[model samples]
Target: MTSQVRGGQLARLLGQWHALPGRRRSPDYAALAAAVRGLLADGRLPLGVRLPAERELAEALRISRTTVTAAYRALRESGHLTSRRGAGSWTMLPGGHRVASSGLWTPQDDLDMIDLGIAALAAPPELVPATRAATEDLPRYLGSAGYHPTGIIELREAIARSYAERGLPTSPEQIMVTNGTQHALDLVLRLALAPAGSVLVESPTYPNALAALAARRARIATHGLALDAGWDADLLLASIRQSRPRLAYLIPDFQNPTGHLMPVDLRERVVGAAHAAGTDLVVDESFVDLPLDGTPVPPPTATFDRHSRVITIGGMSKPYWGGLRIGWVRASAPQVQRLAAARIGVDMSSPVLDQLVAVHLLADAATIVAARRTQLAHQRDALLAALAERLPQWRVTVPRGGVTLWAELDGPVSSALARAAEEVGVRLAPGPRFGLDGTLERFLRLPFTLPAADLVDAVHRIAAVRYDLDRAGRPQWREPSVIA
Candidate 1:
């Protein structure tokens, strides 16, 4: 059973509930109860997760105790919640059903859900031919024991060569392939951080990376990256000096969600600061190759690491295809060896076929990058245009690269808006999902990975829900946070 949620967690969840639509026609208590039921139906509030006390939730939401009591009573009557004299209310599916935690995007059996949660692109046209070509070479590995813990030597050399061309001299010995960047990040965190060790991460960073670090019980220290200003080198330097974290993880190039790239000079300074503070840097270059603009790609962070303090993680998932599931860590040879050894307990090696396909794809990197740049640029523009025409209240920045747009909603009801959008067949990742605690309620990440027509239609659905919320006389809650 999931542990009981209380205080801030429950407050955050309830805040999302309060943002639902149809409040104009329904009683406050009934509206609140229906919001809670919607969350339960969508698996956002998992079955068996205990809720906050009625009074506590009321205070958090700044609503009356009677209102919350009535809402809880309604939920209990509907069989969506259960309460006892002492035990706080617990969420339940109707008929005592249970649902598993499916993270942020749970696919509904319904065919029309437009997924804007995952920031990834489908396989490029090159993937099919590349995989077929890889088959001819597969026979060579068939005679071997078939388990190469680090990676097959050929693929490693190709990756190293790619790095060298980008101004970072890397040996094949410096590379260790993993299932994806997430796995590579996990291995590095395990190798570098002790339990409860401090880790400096970018505020509004990739949610999955935050989840992985939390799982390791690391104490996360944050430095916010302004969408306009990008990384504040001095602030980041100060954070590293003050916190003295064991590691610092950053996505300097076309950062996830925000799409801000750290300048080359800032990159050098950050590496130097981390080195002086004795913190290793884990830089994610997953979106580095997906630049929509024609600017030359920034060199790898390792290029600035005079002390070998940077562990660079790159993957084929974002630029080429997520299904390939091929990623690598470019670190010191010793660190690479350590990570490979640590992988012994996990799956011994990535699939040979996937690695082979990745090698073929990497060989065609320039063409693949160009194709993605053109495609994403078109989709990004379409999304921006749609949002401007349909939801003028939303403020969105034009990302230089990457697949997602970090959009600021007009109010602090992203969770509520997402829930409302779901009823209209649109899936969204609310802002709070990206941040620790209950912050970022006013933000949402919108991906342009879908076709232009679907992108337009998704925006229309979201606008419809926003219209409903507006009609319900929901107070427009605004925040001062601004992103360029």
Candidate 2:
């Protein structure tokens, strides 16, 4: 039996539909078709989800039935939807494959598909040696029960020492190990937020963090981050003072997608403002160690916490390797204990082997940081040059750190471009996926974590798809503009 999505549910899921900005030259039906195809391509409309009937959806959306029928017909011709007699159309991938809705890439995924969706890095060269050393030390723990709810003591102390060295003065009792930064954020949100409680986050922040907050059913308040100016401190402070949310999440160092670092003074002010408003601050430092420009990084946001109101989440995922799956949350001793207790229902503890590997890797933190900095600098430069050569119309900033570049297109067609790019074998994370509302459709986050050759080839493939879109007079493409 097929699962049916009702007219109301489908409309709500689609959110506010806007035509591609700057593409008024295209027909409305074609634009609507592209939007629906984007939803399927990004796994937002899961495979086999029966769409609402054309007439029903058109009435719900207040659009003409002819427009809806034309859009549905286009989708069917493009192989993104299938319809049976007396039945509604259903979503499907090209070639009649039913893709899982998780949107995660597995080892079994199509090997030829170039993935720019995930900003994860591969294992650093030091990981193998570290893993071997961890295996040698594993025998001592074989005699004891391996359930370390607060993480193995050695790993906790190592993480705490890392913070202290960075000027945070953390103690082992104040740290709890987690599977990853995402897991750490989930645990903190579970402990700090209640149903219908208010939360504050930066607009265009990490998508997974937003997902975690949504799962808790918390009301979210957003403060916008300007692409060129970095964080709008005055607006953020005002929001905190006015809303007084239960928690505020900020990525102060080398922020995801945007790659802009929050200045030290602004960081202090934000922390102070949150505390004055009686709000707990959750600072995500996952990208803190990946500075590509050799700038001196600022102290962790916890440095300004005079009232123990700041909780910092860190991980080895970006700087070290995604496969390590080791991260930690640093807070007050009492708060750490509460979080560890709350996390028991979710996950008893992170893997001991991974924690041991993290301990070894942390021992040589400086060396690893130096190596990553050098490698990423080269890749970042290569990607910038490639984009300039191929897609000069797209504006991008050279981020001082972080793995991705947030490129702004001249038109609001990121979702459509991503869908089309997939047909040409490149998968991109559309900018709207990173935002709460259906904004940022003009932006695209491209990771520079791949090798220089792969980065170059990916851009070439993307440019080819973009050219095709332009040739078809698709609204997503625009004439190249002179770079100021």
Candidate 3:
């Protein structure tokens, strides 16, 4: 059965479609078709999902019925949309196969591909030593079953002590280990949110978090962030009061995509709002340890948790290494128990050897993170300089921390550009992947985890692709103004 999207919902998804960037005149039907094609190509619009009627969409967008008709006709001609006499129009890929709904431009094991889709770094030099130490410690537990559901004691205590160092007193019993922060988030959503529950999230949040929510079939309400100003506590407070979602997944520490850190004062207010609304604040601190600018990091959000509902999730992926696959949740002891019980149905527990390795790594986290920060800073500077030299019209805020940059493009052609870049062996994560519906077409996420030289080369290739796209008069071209 095809899932149907209503006209109003489609309108919300196609935000400001007619008011396209750099286009002085009203958008023609070609622009509309291109935007829809972009959405399909990027996987924001899933295949087999029924689209709204042309007249209905035209009414919702306040455009002529003829414009919508022409756009649909173009889509059908291109094999992007299919319609039947009795059945309405539905989305489809050109070859009628499923594409990854993650909306990432992925390279299929292409060695030449420069991947900027994921924001993870290579393992630090300390990992080998840590693994060696962990192997020595592993035999001590060989006598018993290696299943440690709530994580091995050593790792749990180390994680708790790390939180204590950050001014939040956490006990080992309050921590529950999982595969990673993503797994931890899934566990929390399963335990905290009921079926069809509502979740409040930032407009451009971590894409995987949105995926998790969608998998759980949760209703999402978003709070938009101003790229220049960052988060507005007042606006968030209003949203909490109005929507009263069951959970608010926040990434305040160098917030994902945007890279905006929440000030201490705003942190307090955000916690208060969630508390007032009785919302479980799932605060993701995965990127907390990567402050490249030496900005004074604020205390953990758990510091302001008046209620026991603030579930603080931390991981070694961003700071240490993604392959570690170790993460933990810091909540009240009872909450930890509940999460652990629920986790048994999934993967019984994380790998015992990995947990042992995590213990060794956490003991030396500060030194490792400091060196990692220096390397990231260098790469980030390289990427920024390259973007400035090649694509200065695309606006990018200088992020103090985090692995990725949220860049506003020169026009609303991010998806089109991403597809074009693939021809030159550069993979991209278009802006719409991080947003709800088909929104954020005017933005893109660029990660700086690659080597400095590689990052610069990737940017150069992307710039060349954009130039070609512009010159070819592709569907992404903005129509110029006309004087009668």
Worst 10 residues of 2 by lDDT: 475-484
For 66-168, candidate 1 gives per-residue lDDT tens digits of 9999999987876777887885778765552233221332333546778787788888889999999999889999998889888999999999998998888
Q: List, residue by residue over 187-276, the lDDT tens digit for candidate 3.
A: 999999987899999989998999899889999999999887789888998999888899999999999999999999988888888888
Pairs with steric clashes in candidate 2: none
lDDT of 2 at 447: 91
TM-score of each: 0.86, 0.86, 0.85
**How many steric clashes does model 1 contain?**
0
lDDT of residue 165 for candidate 1 = 85
Clashes of 2: 0
- Give Cα distance to truth, residue 472, candidate 2, Å: 2.2
Top model number, lDDT: 3
Question: After best superposition, candidate 1 residue 453: deviation in angstroms?
Answer: 1.3
From the highest lDDT down, the ranking of the candidates is 3, 2, 1
CA deviation > 4 Å runs, candidate 1: 6-107, 473-484
